[model samples]
Target: MTGRIHRTAAGLGPAAPVRAVHLGLGGFHRSHQAWYTAGDPEWGIAAYTFRNTELPRALTEQQGVYTLLVAGEEAEVVGSLSRAHAGADRESWLADLASPDVAVLTLTVTEAAYAVPEPGQDSAVQRVVAGLRARHRSGGAPITVVPCDNVPDNGAVLRSVLRSATRDDRRFAAWVEEQVSVVSTVVDRITPAPTDEDVAAALRATGLRDEAPVRTEPFTEWLLAGDFPAGRPAWERRGARFVPDVGVYQQRKLWFLNGAHSLLAYAGLARGHTTIREAVDDDALAGTVQQWWDTAARHIALDPAEVAEYCRRLRDRFAAPGIRHQLRQIATDGSQKIPARWLPVLRAERAAGRLPGAVVTGLAAWLLHLRGGEVRDPRAAELVESAGSVRRALLALDEEVGADDELVSAVEAELHRT
Candidate 1:
């Protein structure tokens, strides 16, 4: 059968449904959340990119439609998004939030965007508070805010930020605390940035070029533990789990999967591998990742059975032949990722009087990569400016470094040596 593409209001067809709002309008959002919404038109998403008008412009031009190619080990499962739009229409984006049709507010603001204020804040949370306050003043119904960043206490962090910003505004804050629902979530999907060639291939697959095509692995998971303030997608109907606790799930993904991904990102970049598939295919680096996962696994609280299952899924996803997820992309924002991804496990190891060797090595690689000496990922330059001296960075971030000597020495020693 010849592959063909279609454009509709929602992206797939005119009859496709729409609802919901997402903040970070990026490729991963398209492949994962939008793809899920497309599976069931009843849940369409209104999305806005952060500080950039590019995605909104392209998406608008494409008629708010794009292809979702679920590239597997070799094949692809293609779909379309009909309900997505760039925040080029800010009024429209907020209107949906104020409308009865949109209930859930999902975010993919990446780690850095969440770093509004310094160590504590110089009114850092004010912006988020103002945003929410405006939405509240918009006279909209209550809404649930789900943050998909890698922050440990994501919902609490965002809520605190919002509250701190609005603390002076008693009336608005009270309304928010009572009416808004903040949901903590753990999202896993190794969707990579598509290269020029990959974009060409996606277009070739459909015999039509799409300006905003997204490529991702077949695996995806969303674990939530909070109330949907106003309401939410029947995401559970599509395999999204609303668990009583997302802590174990969060740790499992953060410490092992993300930890290992970070390790390989720096280590692999030092070895000159560009994409994740290339890094995993390298036996030495893949072995390092497995070893890191092994060491980090001991700290996670999930059932050993589920932990093993997650590892299998991660391996398959990383091995995805068609997804060219760049190592550099994952390697971005180490300053923010280190605290949430590596520091907690190190603290746990110290508390238990155990040495997390794999995690230590991963940290060492990050330190080395951040020191601006080994890794070739140019983006690392600006991302880890604080890495020049871990001591100052940690102190500045107010991060409790339990294994001070070991951690610092490990990272410093590997700085030039590694």
Candidate 2:
């Protein structure tokens, strides 16, 4: 390798001034928001990793520059990030939030991170409350808070949690109400955790050791709803959509894209498959995944034609040969993700007096995967302890799902068949 990548060596003169602060900086953040901001000269991100210092260290070493390796295509060097910091860098974090020039704050801290925290505990909500307090005490300016996780009504979800965090401080909460604008967003991209092989490929291609290279699929889509009071980037120029409401798009993606990925992850692992391509390529698993998609589509509010086109594109994206999306990665946090991705459709189909057979199978697979003893979840104990019984597993997922004897029986039957 020639050396570590830098703005100058990567053919980028200098990154933009820091005008945005991003939390939970990971592969998806790098591949999606950072890449989108690369097209705008006015925005630069001060990215901070949630818990891992390695990513921040690497990106900081590289001067917040990294390679975006799209599957089966040439890689691009992205430099929209001005600086990187570990989450423990609270002084800098608060300073960034306090800066009047920083108008945007984005999050990709996963669906489970939005939960209100226990007293004397640190959480995503607690962190945001701290930042807002700092900003209020300094020079309070309007800032757009964007939640790019897969939760439905993500902006509302975040705002509600923030309210809980700031319940005792009505003054701070009132200031937040007057100044903060939470934008709900639907973000899509398949950025797998970079493997050693990916790092080698990057070095071979660019003659530089890219310690933090992000390998992603070619397809990327982002839809956002709500306001940016202090202004924001022209993300539409980079194919990001500003919709009147992101609810429908979120349903379409959560049920179809994320839902199907979770299916393949759980079911595919049970069937002894590895990467996403291998899992989708299995004819038997593919059929079940398609059934899940069709069933989920029946519940989304979008036009059938639009949903179908999205599914068609998803199939191609999942079958992409160059990307190595590990099943275990998507399979993490199933206790949190399954409800968001599958519960709405499951509840709807059941209410319509339909069995939703494919969902039954998906549920069975997840239960089995839980018992396999490798899942990382806040509720792992509850899930694993209940996995032996379909009823218990269903209860662990949601009380309504478990309370329904009929639904539990269906899941039980599916588990037996598997």
Candidate 3:
């Protein structure tokens, strides 16, 4: 690799004015949204990392320009971001939110980040609400807030949270109703956290040392539904789809892609596999994934042919070589992910008087993971404490699921088999 090359707007092109502000500046954002935005040089992003100062510090030093390596294909330097800020930088964030020039705000904070706050706690939703409040106070400029997280009805969820946050201020709440648009979006991309070797390979490929390069599979998709009153990027030109309703698409991706990912994270790890590609390559795990997909297809309202094509694409993504999507990484935050990823399908299947073996097996694998030791979840302590009883643990994790004796028994039976 050649000597270190610091990426900056100066090295790429003159920085565009910030027209979009993004929350949760992570690898997925760099690989997916920022890459999409890069298609239109006129639209620049001012992004903030969720909680980490390190990434922001690194990107700020590099002037928000970073390399995006599409594994086994090519590497390109992306320079769509003009500024990087810490999420805690309320002043800067508020200024951007209140700015009439910023027509759009995007978020990639995970599902858990949308959790209703405990008093005085700062959350992603809370931060957005604060920004909106600032905007409401200073001439409300209509803006679209697109939530790109993997949650069903994400737009509705964010709107609810924002409304709740400003309920005490009747004027602000009315301003939100009049001025803000919550856009639901479904984003798909297999972006693995770059390993040391991956970073080394990027340096070798590019002949320049980059501290913040992101590695991702070639496949990517973004489907959005909602209004953008102040105008937004022509993301549709860059493989993004704008639809009247993203519900079906969202459900399809959540159940098929994310649900299967969770299954692989737990079931695959139990089978001594660490990465998605390795797990999908194994016949047994691949079959289990297919079974999960079949179960999910029953509930998701979509054309069978389309769903099949999506499934095929998902399998290809999971099996992509040189992309080490880690099970441990997917396995993190199961408590938050399970609600959207698995529970809905499981409930729907049971309500129809059929047992979902694949879903049960996935849940059983998670329970086994808890017993296996060293879980990296926020609720690890509670999960581990109840690991002895599948029913107890299920209840502790989600009361609705725990209340069902048959489901709990099924999970217990599956646990024994595992």
Candidate 4:
């Protein structure tokens, strides 16, 4: 246990059978889904990462067991991640998907990953389609696809990706129509990008020199809609809720929690704050977050008390100094995140004849953030290279936001606040 100990050598917990396959093997997936799966002894995840090969290599070396650093204190070793592999391990990927034993395939790469794969790039969704197609030829067993990203109707979106990808393959496409049940999920957990202290903390908390420790907040939630046809882990045992519909629940989360987060990430970074704790604790930024929440709360279909409680809890979570959720990390992929988390609020408020001040402010912060040149989006060249292309950049997020002169003016007005 002294130098880079493996899970077997550490004897943390027994690894479960690999009954699940997860794309995007990252900290969020580890802290959230795999953490729940860690509780369910029946299933384990054979997770893969195409982009970050180093992760799979590290996890594989560590025997797919990593410490879950909750609140930067307690380090519980999660062993449900039974196997880790790279996306290029397509043979294994196809085998897992084709096998009737692997019943559920979940993904959380990011909204940017859902875009059509570039030339020679294998997107996560494309890999899923390929796997499912293979499953069809291998005596297709009913499998469930649960999309755990922030995309609205994530399940339907993934389903569309599958359908569009397999349109020429008539037999496989029909098999998909019958065999796949894409489940939409609303997942919440604040898993910051790991810091250098994480490795040291894991070693201190668990007598093991771990490399891939997942540091996350104490708060977590998972609400799902749709059936697990072949079978799935009893995720409910680990506080996961399976509901008839996750539509309203998703909106509440996307508009309120994620929307506020986008605001904080941009505005906080602009204000020279580094982490969520610093940003949320700042009086001015805190007030802006509250305003954004109030604006979104007007549209969320949840009870006022419930929304208030959720916001209260969010403040507590955000204020936890231990969380250390980085504003810059959250700031990445602003183009994708803005459309998902802020566009609805912007459009709704404008249509209601009330301009969303906080939304405008967040947009201004984001545009300025773009011009500051730390942007990590697919459209980085067009949007971030020059400051004069404000309309082009705004249009990239939404046509309405781009076209509305008043909204554009409001954002421009806020941009001058500095």
Candidate 5:
């Protein structure tokens, strides 16, 4: 901790009413949404950390103000969040939801959080259902729930989950149907967890100790498509785009950016590279990423020039020297990630009767990664046990891909190449 202290109120005016409540308060939210919200003084966010008490405690101690360190660029204190709480704070969470002022609810919880989540289980959807129930009972003011997770059709997915969660109560379900809008979003930013050096540098630069400083690449984007019934901040003024549809943009990100990232994570780890920059610096792995992007681009419906430029920018972002995005970190939760990042494209290519080499290679690398050592995944036991069967792994991930012999053979051949 540094000697100097800069309170949130010092830089920004009196704490604004909470107009947004965010789930999964991590570095990405700070670097992306909170940074955009900082552009508008009238909006303040009540952010909740995902299962971590330390971050919320630290942010609370700092008066919900922290430093944003743009890797190899600049550092600035962000004051958009007015409150921070542990995810388990039911009273505070319910109160915030019941408040009529909160018009937008954003989430950065990962994909697995929304899958068959039991009520009151550490599930993002469960928490949202509880909040929405509270809001519905308390005047049922309309709110837009924006999912910032990197899943395709995230808005619809969330709505489906909410529907299932509240299916027992027809009144609550009806209220949700009438009063809530789920917004699909395309959010991009390479926000790596800050290193000890980053913390020291922030202290040197600002003369204040920021326990929860976020370090991210300079590139950032947020595209939202949906209604905000209770209104929202002018986030568009701060680089966020409100488009009519985010499908093309979402596919571009999911396939090109996130798909390439998954490829690098598995393949790079297999090659002993730790960070994304090191992986991209390796000629073979970088070529593999490029190949994956080329194959992925075939499926996106965006303008050719835009897709090309997006791919070009993706290469630059991946090669950022200052960003130490760890491949191991990306490799975690591969079971949940691969379905969205790889399977859709792989299935589409297979349906077109063309076996995608890059997709096969990525799948093989992930299988090889499973064979490498113990991994952190919910389905780790099944993955380890099914190492010999590509069909088993694919089926375990999604039953829809049921024993596709041709696809299995392609993945096996690629696995042998590894």
Candidate 6:
């Protein structure tokens, strides 16, 4: 912990153990999970970005110190963040994974990282398995890999991919199958990408220019089910809920918040909107999102009242004038996201002999976004391969990527119109 940053909550007692490794050290991790970790002295996170070197360099300079501003409905919750290490220091990251001191691996690599293509039939999933195999061979400690992304059955998906990727390694494969636990989770928070102005404001608020600072809406919820082989943070203390089944909770978020977010990204973008706030403020676009949520709420497994409450909360979060979540940022990787976020309910509604109007509209917008040639995004590479066949793309997605004949036809009709 030498030269590392420390942010003490006055009278907050002792620090927790440093026992977890986070794979993607981006803004959301800084704000939500790290924020929760701040309350426990039992775990400190060692964070690694996928391939970028900028965040690590910045944090190294500041001794890994940063601040998280939880902008609430009527107030802001500002606090200093401590107990984090950068993963760019590869030796340290790998060493920690191999140590009993670290018992958990958390991931937030986003939707695309899960499905990147590789030579032959290999993909990024295989690459992750190969990495895990190497670590296992080198005496990496038994631990849990918790995926904090929005996808359903995330843990199972990862486990299948890892097993598939390492089929030849019977010994190694068995070790992973028995010892490695991949936990699925439902994570919710509305954290916008920080702008330069927002960064400056954060610095002035704390008198420190945190190169990797994070800003988020006040509401935060996490539901997880999995066991840690070694140990884990006493995160349950900070309003983190553990349950036998996180299905209902996961569905509530995926369809309402994530699904609505996609609607805003695709449909709103077509309407010349850039930021989520801009899109939500527009009557037509905002209504589109609200109406989608209305139809989607009916499909969720949770109580109608609870879904309604969640939607109300989403409105408040999206209305934040201080947040600057870009439409294009959420708009990217539609190929991966649509299957997880939107398709399930569409398929469900169609199975019940109903038209999935909002879902079809979102699918249409996504197809338009993927049509290629006009929209220029840095992440354009992911959308290129699947541009020609909407049906094939939708079908190839996971089983949970649900849609039926009527729903598919509606989307197809809309795509044709576009």
Please name the candidate that would achieve the greatest TM-score relative to the true structure: 2
- Write the residue-wise lDDT of candidate 5 on 1-418 in tens digits: 3453346433556566799999989989999999999899899999997679998998888888888888778788888999999977989999998899999999998877767675457677778888999999899999999999988889988888888888899999999988999999999999987688877877876878878888888899999999998999889988999999899888888888988998999999988899999999999988888888778878878788898899889888988777899998888888888888888888888889988888777888888888888687878998888866788877887776647777788888877777
Please, what are the lDDT tens digits per residue for candidate 2 over residues 1-418?
Answer: 2789999889987878899999988999999999998889888999987778998999889999998888888999899999999889999999999999999999989888988888878777778888989999997888989999988899999999988788798888898988999999999999888898878888877888899999998889999889999989878889999889988888888889999999999999999998889999999989998899889877778888988898899999989888999999999999889999888998999899998877888898998898899779888888888888888788778999899998888878888888
Better of 2 and 4 by TM-score: 2
Q: Tens digits of per-residue lDDT for model 6 on 38-85?
A: 667556676776566777676655545566666643222222232345
Q: Which tens-of-lDDT digit does each residue in 50-143 have in candidate 3?
A: 6789888877777787788897887888889889998778899999999999999999988878776767888888788888988887899999
TM-score of 6: 0.84
Judge candidate 6 against the unseen true structure and give its global Cα lDDT, from 0 to 1.
Answer: 0.69
Highest-scoring model, lDDT: 2
Model 4 C-alpha lDDT per residue in residues 178-232, reported as the tens digit of each score: 8899999999999999888999999988888888998998889999999888988
The global C-alpha lDDT for each of the candidates, from Candidate 1 onward, is 0.69, 0.89, 0.87, 0.86, 0.86, 0.69
List per-candidate RMSD values in Å. 4.0, 1.1, 1.8, 1.6, 1.8, 4.5
Q: For model 2, what is the alpha-carbon lDDT of residue 211?
A: 93
User: Candidate 5 vs candidate 6: which has greater TM-score?
Assistant: 5
lDDT score for residue 59 of model 5:
84
**Model 5: lDDT of residue 22:** 94
Query: What TM-score does each of the candidates earn?
Result: 0.86, 0.98, 0.95, 0.96, 0.95, 0.84
Query: Which portions of model 2 show Cα errors greater than 4 Å?
Result: none
Candidate 1: C-alpha RMSD to true structure equals 4.0
